[model samples]
Structure formats: structure tokens, C-alpha cells
Target: MAYNDNDGDFPGETSTAREELRAEAREVLCRLVGREDADFHPGQFEAIEALVADRRRALVVQRTGWGKSAVYFVASLLLRARGAGPTLIVSPLLALMRDQVSAAARAGVRAEAINSANATEWDQIRERLAADTVDVLLVSPERLNNPQFRDVQLPDLIRRTGMLVVDEAHCISDWGHDFRPDYRRIRDLIAQLPGAGDRRVPVLATTATANERVVQDVAEQLGVAGADGSGEVFVLRGPLARSSLRLGVLRMPSPASRLAWLLTHLGSLPGSGIVYALTVSAAEDTARALRDAGHEVVSYTGRTDPEQRAELEQALKDNRVKALVATSALGMGFDKPDLGFVVHLGAPSSPVAYYQQVGRAGRATDHADVLLLPGTEDREIWRYFATTSMPDEHRARAVLGELEAAGKPLSVPALETRVDLKRTPLELLLKVLAVDGAVERTQGGWQRTAQPWTYDGERYGRVAQARLAEEKLMLDYENTSGCRMEFLSHVLDDPEAAPCGRCDNCAGPWFPTGIDETAKGSASKALGRVGVPIEPRRSWPSGMDRLGVPLKGRIPEESQVAEGRAVARLTDLGWGGRLRTLFTITEGGVQDAPVEQDLLQGAVQVLASWEWAERPIAVVSVPSRSRPQLVGSFAEGIARIGRLPYLGSLELVDGGPRGESGGNSAFRLASVWRMFSVPEELASQLASARESGQHGPVLLIDDRTDSRWTLTEAGRVLRGAGASGVLPFVLALNG
Candidate 1:
């Protein structure tokens, strides 16, 4: 393989040049897969041509198994041979980056990655980059703006970079189903690259799932013009419908039915594959239910530790387990050619998202089963996620005002004291704001930038509306009168969408709709199982002094509450839906009602099963502004049933805690600081219990636990008043 410098410093233009490039790519492809017959798929060669020869921005929209990775590896090697710098790839997830790096190595491409999982290797990677020994450099989107990388390493990489590849490029569009704020930073990085005819750095972005709207948005962000405009960008789109997928929908009446169906029928599917749930609790509970039925299944969600996630992925890939009951986080960049099926316990909010998840199965197999079990509760879950993605105007302004008022960098915790937003949402808003040039993250913390910022209310509103429309489209998909795969492809704007004859509508339901009654009973039992221990707060939140609360450091052991119990987390599969209904806040305030009979029975079951050092000797209630009657009755019922005396409730002074629910620790802690005190009469009664050799933990009851700060603060006050120990009992755990 040789290049002529006199061939005008450009690789391909005439048919002869293209033929030569394709021949070389074929040779590299054979070396990559170790198969002499390996060749490019339909659009792969065109994408390579655009990047290597045309030196233009290109986006590839093809099916999951279209060999998108081969194009990039071949392009990188081809460019490197011609004296171009190493390719910079902005991958989305750490696991995905690892997969890419491994694949590149098989092609004999020297690809190195910098991610959260590898700190020690970074130095070695930097050395390789400095020595010009690395062919490709992979980093997560989050790393694009990291203090060290953005300030130190990125400028030089951008200057000499031969190609920039954005894998999973749909994330760049806010209108897309899975949008990340950090992904928008690529636009800025793209701007810094040289932009001339031949000297411009070529860029390639690829994804399997992006509608026409998303594709246009992503292209605009990448500075790529579509076919309607000047020929600045080249987009190679292929049919997204997978011929091997046999699709169907099983309408389960309830969560129990859904689990029972899975427990009864999972093995009937071809072989090992993925089972997706909408929430972590659902995934865990479903996996447990399946395991209890003698099925080898494991749970994979965002909460699964990164190390464990890798192990689990490998476990599934190796067929060591029957299935991985997972959430949406498991879908992207995972590859297993022989995966047999995909079963969704609940549907995703958009057709695009559903297609991406189902695309995981039947990639290389002759046949793979894809089934959806739709639940009535899915819309509520969709609404919860929808609320988080868009930035709250008030919250954004408050963050900017705090940073501007301070006139310096403040850590997130410091900002939390002054702003009233939860940590996750606050962090997401900061990323969005940072990309918009409102605030900038630095080594010290976040600081206000000189760039003026506008709220862009109309833009966010349009995005929200577009999301709602997508949700409606998803619902329509459930009851579609046409082929399921064709519907999904039409939603994604695939030009060649046609009825997939394998679907239930096309060929009749190939899946069993019957579930075993025994499985249903077992699933109900699993969902109904109660009692999750709430870990006690051992230390106070920092930056509390800013809120005028003089609390810091480890709390005294005597004042710390013992580990508490809740009937279940609010996100639990079985009890969670009911609890959510009971605590549903209306336009005015939370409803004040007594404990429901079934929940009271559940509480009694929790107490009977509790393995306590000493059972609670007495019960005391926390002051509740929104649900006083509910908390009062719950405490009284527990005290009566346990044969323990019911002490008086704690007294709320100074208008009872300030602010509303759902904020960061410092703000939440300070809002409830010094807000409660033990009643004198109750204090005397508790003191009598301790004096009379009844030195057991007294139960402290509350309706719910969000931050657990209320329990900690109340426990401190009760300890001061002479309670020997405090044991917390709550109706629900918020998170």
C-alpha cells in the first residue's frame, strides 16, 4: 500500500482512486476480522470515502449490525498512513469506549482511552500521544470539558486531529429521547478545528436510532448541511428494520401479571438476552422473582457498580446467565451477536428508544423474539423522566445569581446552600448552563462567565412538546393496526420501511399469552415483600453554616438514630405504586388521611420480622404539616398493636421547617434545622421508661423519609430530653 504525494495530497476523486482506496480498505478489513472474505456493508465504504477522501463531516444512520465500527477503523488507518494526526473519538459511556478500544486493537489500530475507570493508565496514554505512537484516542463526552483535559490536552489534540468521531450521535439533539448536556460541548470543539477545503479536520458521527428531526438537529450541531443544502455534508442512511426480529405485544393487566408472565415464559424465548424494566426497583424485583423461580438471572441498572456492570455484561455475553433484567442504561454499545430475545416489562416513552433497545437482540441470529408487556403505570414513569431533562428556569436563574453574587467559583455544595434544587437536577442544569456559556466549571468550582445568557423558554417548551408527541406515538404503537417493526421504522423516518412479516400482526401471535397461576402468586408475594432498612445519618452535611445552622462533622453517637425501617422504597415494584398513590400531592397540598388497612398490615409484618437488639418500648410521632392525621394514626396504630405506650408527638416551633421537599443535603438539612422539640410531658414519659430498666430504642414514626434529616434532627432533640435510643419507622423511603 503506497500513497503518491503527487496524487494531489487528496486520496479519492476519480473512480480509479476510489477503487484503490476500496481495495486497501478490503485488505485492512480482512486483517481486522481475520477473514479473507470480510468486506464493507453498503454505506460503510461511502462513509469512509467522505471522511478520508472528501474530508467532510458525515453522519451514518444504519441498522445495529451494519459494521459502523469498521468504517472508522479503516478510515483512521488510511489517514494515519498519509501522515494525519490521531483520530479523536468522543464516545458516550466508559464501557462503550472500552469495547471500541478492544475492537480497534483487533484491527491492529493503536487506540487508547481516558475514562473514569482508568486513572493510572492516563499517564501512559499521554506519553503515547506525545510520542505520536497512538492511532486513535477515545474519551467520554463528559471528559470533553474536564478541567485537566479541556485546559491542557485538548487544544493540541484538536490542532493535529485527523478525524473526530461522535458515536451514538443522537444524544446531541435535545429533542432526542436520550439527551446529555455534555454532548453539546462537541459543537464548540468542532468550531475550534480548522475549516478550509482540504486542511479541514474530517468528522464522522454515527448512530442506529435517530428520526428525521433528530438527524437534522444533530447535523446542524455538527455543522453538516443536509442534502437540501450545499454539499458540505454526506449522510448515508440505510433501512433500520431488522428482518430477524419477531415482535409482539402482551397486554398485562398489572405489574404482578407482567412478572408472572416473565417468570412463566422467559425460557420459551430462543436463548439468553435482555429483559428491560422502566425502573431500578422493577428490574431488581423482576430479576429476584425470576431467580426465586430457579431461573439464572441478574439485575443491571444505573445503580449497579461500574465494576459489577462489566462483570454482568460479560456474564450475559458468555451465556453464564439466562438473562440480565436491566434498565435503559444497558442498551448502548453492548454487542452480542447471538442474543436470542428482548422482553420489556414496561415500554419506553418513545418509538425511537424502543427500537434501539429491541435492536439489541437478533443482530446476527436467524431469529430473535422481541415482546413488550405494556403497563398502565408507564405514563407516570415517563412524566417523571420528562420533568428532569428540561432545565427549570427559576432554578437556572437562581444558580447564576448565586455565582454572580459571590463573584467567584463555588463548589456544588456551596451553591446548594443558597439554591433550592436536588443534586442530580442541579448538576444537570449546571451542565446545560455551562454549554450555553452561562456558568463555567473550573478547578476551584463553578464561576459566572462574561457571556450573557438567555433562558430560551420557547426552545425548551418546543422540546417538551415534541417529547409529549413522542410519548403519544409510543402509546399508539402499542395498539398499532399495522406491523410493529414497520411502525417503528416509519416513526424513525426510514425511507424503506415495510411490514416485517414475522411480527404478531403479520403472522399471528407467536408468543404464549397464558401465565401460570402459581407464578402469579409467587410474583405477588415477591412484590408484596416489605421492609427496607434506612441507614442512619452518621454525619452532618457540610456548608450548613451558610444557612445559619451550626451543625458540622460526625454526629454524636448518642444522638444518632438507629437504622430505620420503611415498608418499601417509593420506587419498589409492588408496594411502590400504592404508596405513590397514597402520597400523591395535589395542587394544594398532600392529602391528610389515615393509614390504609393493607399498609398497616404490611407495617405489622415488618415489625414482626424486624431483628432488633431490643424491640421498641414506646412510640413517638414527628410533627407533620401536610399529613399530620396520617402520621398520627400510623404511630398510634403501631403503638397499640405492639402493646407499647404512645407518647406525645414532637412539637414544631418557628412555623415548622422552611422550604419544600426535593433539594440538596445542605439546603434540605438547614431547612429542617432546629425545627422540632420533644414535648415536656413526652420527655418525662420517655425518661420514666429508661429509669425503669426499659432501656430499649423508642420508635420515632413519620409518614415518609426524603432526606432523613428530619429523623436525625428529631432524634438529637429526643436524646437531649432523655430517650435512651431512637428507632425510626417511616411509611415510605422517597429514594
Candidate 2:
């Protein structure tokens, strides 16, 4: 391999040079896959030519497994041979980066990555970069703005960089299904790169899923104004259809029926693959249900540890497990070419997102199953996620006001006291603000910037409307009489959209709608098996001292509530759906109703199977401002069933703060402390029972537990009144 100094430097008149480059790329691709006849997919060569031979920015929007990675790996090799510097790739997820690093090695490219997981290896990687021994370097979008990297390493890399590749480029657009604020920094990064004279660094952005609007937005960002004031970008988009995927939709009557369907038919599905769930609890519960049915399965979600995720991914790849019940966290950057199925427990809010997830399957196989078991609660889940993604102008302004008033960097916790928002939403708002130039992060924390910030009300409104429109589009996808694959393709602006001839509608239904009765009974039993351990709060929230609560780390064991039990989580797929109806509110206010018989029976079953150290001797209800009848009936029913005395409810002191249902621990603790008190008569009875050793812990009952502060505070009052210990039992746990 040799290079003329002028090779691939000047653009627009290099037909011979371009042909030579493509020939070299073909050889590299062969080496990469260990095949002499390896070739590029349609439009892949054009994308590669734009970056390597033409020296122009390009966007490649193609389906997964379309050899998008091949284009970049081969281009890097060709450019390096031509005396260009290493390729810089801005990748999104750790899994994606790991896969790319290994793939690059096959083509004889030395690829290294700088990410959170490899902190210990960064010094070595930096040394490699400095010695010019690295052919390609992959970094997370967050690293682009990292304090140390931005101040030291980036400028040098920019001057020497050969090509810039933005993997998962859809993240750059606000309209994207998975947008991240850190990705917006790419535009500014491009502006800072040296572009003296007419020559500029070539950039290539790639995504497997992006609609027309997202494509335009990302292209505009990537094609930043060069030194010559040109913002030209070449885009090569192809059909979004996956020939290997056979799509179908099953409208189940309830969550139990869906679980029953999986239990009865999962093993019969072609081969090992993924089961997509909308929520973490759903994934976990589904995995458990499948495992209980004697199937080898695992659960993967955002809550999964990085090391564990790696192991799980490998387990799936090796076919050690039948399937990995997972959330969207397991979607991107995960590659298993022979994967045989992708089953969704609920539809995603957008058609683009659905396509992205389903694309994970049948990448290399001749056929793969794609089934959507749409749930009634899917729309509610979509609304929640949509609202969380959109920034609230009121909350944004409050954050800015607090930072401006401080005139100094403030930590997230310090800012939490002044703002009404919780930590997650607050952090998200700060990130958005930082991208909008309203505030900036520093070593200490975050500080306001000199840049004037105003709410983009109209823009945000448009984005919100767009989200709703996507929801509607997803609904259309579910109910459309037309081709499902074509509907998804049209949504992605694929000009080649047509009947896939492989989907359920095109080929007639290949899946059975009826579930076996035995499997249904087994699923119902697993879901109805109620009792989740409620781990007691071991420590108090910091800053309680400032609020006059006088609490700090490691709460005294005596003051702690004993481990308790809840009938179900509000996010659980089984009891959750029915329990949700119990809390539903009408137009004006809550529906004040007594406990339903079935739910009451479920609660009793939870108590019957509870593995308490000592059985509860008495039942005491916590004062409920809303749903008093429901709570009262639940407590009384428990007492009657156990033949235990009802010690009566805790007294809600007037003038005491009415506790909020949900918020951070600090505020929740302050609001509820001293608000609950044990009456003199019940206190005497409880103290007598403990003194006489006639009973064990008293069961403190509540309708639901969200923050758990109310339970903690009420438990403390009972403990102070000399009850042996306070054991909590609730109908539901709100995550």
C-alpha cells in the first residue's frame, strides 16, 4: 500500500483515483469477513466514495446489517493508506463501540475506544493516539465535551483527523426516537475543526433508522459551514425493509393472555432471540415467568450492570438462552446476525422506533419472526415517556433563576432544594440548558453562562405535536389493513417502500391467535403470585438537618421499619393493569370506592405467604386523606381474617403538613414527619403487648407506597410508642 501525496486530497475530478480506491475497499472488505468475494450493498459504495475519494460529507441511512460498518472500516483503511490521520467515530452506546472495535480488527485496523467503562485503560489509549499507532478511535458523544478531552486532546486530534463518523446519527435530531443532548455538541465540534483553504475533513454519519425530518436535521448539523461557507452534504438512503423478517401483530385481551401466549409458544418460535418489553418491571416479570415455565431466559434492562449486560449479550449470541426479555436498552449496537425472532410485549410510540427494534432480528438469517402483542396500556406508557422527554418551560426557568442567583457553580443536590423538580428531570433540564447555552458545567458543579436564554415555546410545541403524531402513526401501523412493512418503510421516507411480501398481511397470518388453557392458567398463577419484598429504608436522605428533621446517614436500627411486603408493583404486567384501575380518577377527583373483593383476596394471599421473621399480632391502618374507605376496608379485612385485633388508625394531627404522594426523599420526609401520631389508647395497648410478650410486630397497612416516607414516619411513631417493631404491608408499590 502506497500513497501519492496528492491522492484523495482534491475533490470532483478523480474518476481513476476513485476506481482505485473502490478496488482497495473491496479487498479490505474481503479481508474483514474472511471471504474473497465480499462486496458492498446497494448505495454503500457511493457512501464510501463520498468520504474517501470525493472528500465530501455523507449520510448513509440504510437498514441494519446493510454493511454500514463495513463502509466506515474500509474507508478508514483506504484513507490511512493515503497518508490521512486516524478516523474519529462518535458512537452512542458502549455495546455498539465494543462491536465496532472488534469488527475493525478483522480489516487490520487498530481501533480503540474511550468510554466510561474503560476509564483505567484511557491513559494507554491516549498514549496510542499520540504515537499515531491507532488507525481509528471511537468515543462517546459525552466525551466530545469532556472537560479534560476538550481542553487538551480534542484540538490535536481535530487537526490530524481523517474522517468523522457519527454512529446512530439520529440522536443528533430532537425529532429522533432516542435523542440525547450531548449529541448536539457535534455541530460545534465540526465548527472548531481546522478547515483552512478549500480542503476540509471528510465526515460520514450513519443510522439504521431515521425519518425524512430526522435525516434533514442530522445532515444540516453534519454539513456545518466550512471555511468556504459551504454546507453541502450528500445523502444515500435505501429501502428500510428487511427481507428476513416476517411481521405480525397479536391483539391479546390482557397482559395475562400475552404472557400465556409466550409461555405456550416461545419454544416453538424458530430460534433464540429477544423479547422486547416496554418497562423494566415488565421485562423482569416476563423473564421470571418464562424461566418458571422451565425455559432458559434472562432479563436485560437499563438497571442491568454493564458487566452483566456483556455476559447476557454473549449468552444470547451463544444460544445458551432461549431469549433475553429486554427493554430498549438492549436494542442498539447489539449484533447477532443469526437471531431468529423479536417479539414485542407492547408497541413503541413511533413506527421508526418499532422498525429499529425489529431490525435487530433476521439480519443474517433466511427468516425470522417479528410479532407485536399490543397492550391497552401502551398509549399511557407512550404519554409518560413523551412528557418526560419534552422540557417544561416553567422548570427550565426555575433552574436558570436559581443558578443566576447563586452566581456560582452549584451541585445537583444543592440545586434540588431551591427547585421543585426532582433529580432526574432537573439533571435532564440542565443538560438541555447546557446545550442551549443557558448554563455550563464546571469542576464544582454547574454555573450560568453569559448567553441569553429564552424558552423556545413554539419549537417545543412543535416537537410535542410531532410526538403525538408519531403515536398516532404507531396506532395506524398496528391497525392498518395495508402492508405493515411498507407502512414502516414509508414512515422512514424510504422511496423504495413496497409490500415486503414477508409480513403477516402480505403472506397471511403465520401465528396462532389462540393460547393453550393450561399455559394461561400457569401464567395467571405466576402473575397472581403476589408478594414483593419491601426493603426497609436503611438510611435517611441528606440535608434533612437543614430542614429541621435532624436525620442523616444510617438511620438507627430501632427506628427502621421491618422488611415488608407489597401485593404487586404498579408497573407489573399482571396485577398492575387491574390495580391501575383502582387508582383511576374521573374528571374532577378520585373515585372513592371500597376495596374490590379480588384485590382484597390478593392482599390476603400476600400476607398468607409472607415470610416474616415474626408474624404480625395486630393490624393498624395509616390515616389516608384519599381512599380512606379503601384503606380502612383493607386493614379491617386483614384483621378479621387473621383473628387479630384492629388497633385503630393513626391520628392525623391538624396543622401538620399534608404529605405529598411523590417526590424526592428529603422533601417527602419533611412533609410527613410529626404529621402522624399514635393515640393514647392505642399506644397503651401496643406497649402492653410488647411488655407482656404476647404478640410480635404490628402490621402497619397502607393503600400504596411510593416514596415510603409516610410508612417510615408512621412506623417511627409506633416504635416510639413501644411497639415491638413496625412491619408494613401495602397493596401496591409505585416505582
Q: Number of the top candidate by lDDT?
A: 1
Model 2 reaches what TM-score against the true structure?
0.95
Over all chains combined, what TM-score does candidate 1 have?
Answer: 0.96
Candidate 1: C-alpha RMSD to true structure equals 3.9
- List the pairs of residues colliding in candidate 2: none
Lowest lDDT 10-residue stretch of candidate 2: 1-10
- Each candidate structure's count of clashing pairs: 0, 0
- Over the stretch 1-735, how does candidate 2's per-residue lDDT look in tens digits? 111112333235657767787788889989988899888766666678777766777888889999889989988998898888999999999999989999989879999999999999999999999899999999999887676887788999998998889999999999888888989989988777655433567888899899889999998998886756545788777678898899999899888899999999999998899999998889999999999889999999999999899899999999999999999999789999999999999988988889999999999999999999999999866654545455788878888998999999998888876666678878878888988888888877889999998888898888878888989999999999889999999999877789988788998899987788989998888877788888888898777776778788897878889988888987788887777777767697887677888988998898888888888889999988888899999999899988999999999977545545665678888888889899999988887787877768999999999778888989988888887788999998876
Relative to the unseen true structure, what is the C-alpha lDDT of residue 82 in candidate 1, on a scale of 0 to 100?
A: 84
State the lDDT of candidate 1 residue by residue for 167-214, as single tens digits.
Answer: 999999998998999999998888788777556788888899999898
Which residue runs does candidate 1 get wrong by more than 4 Å?
Answer: 1-14, 224-231, 587-589
Clashing pairs in 1: none
* lDDT for 217 (candidate 1): 81
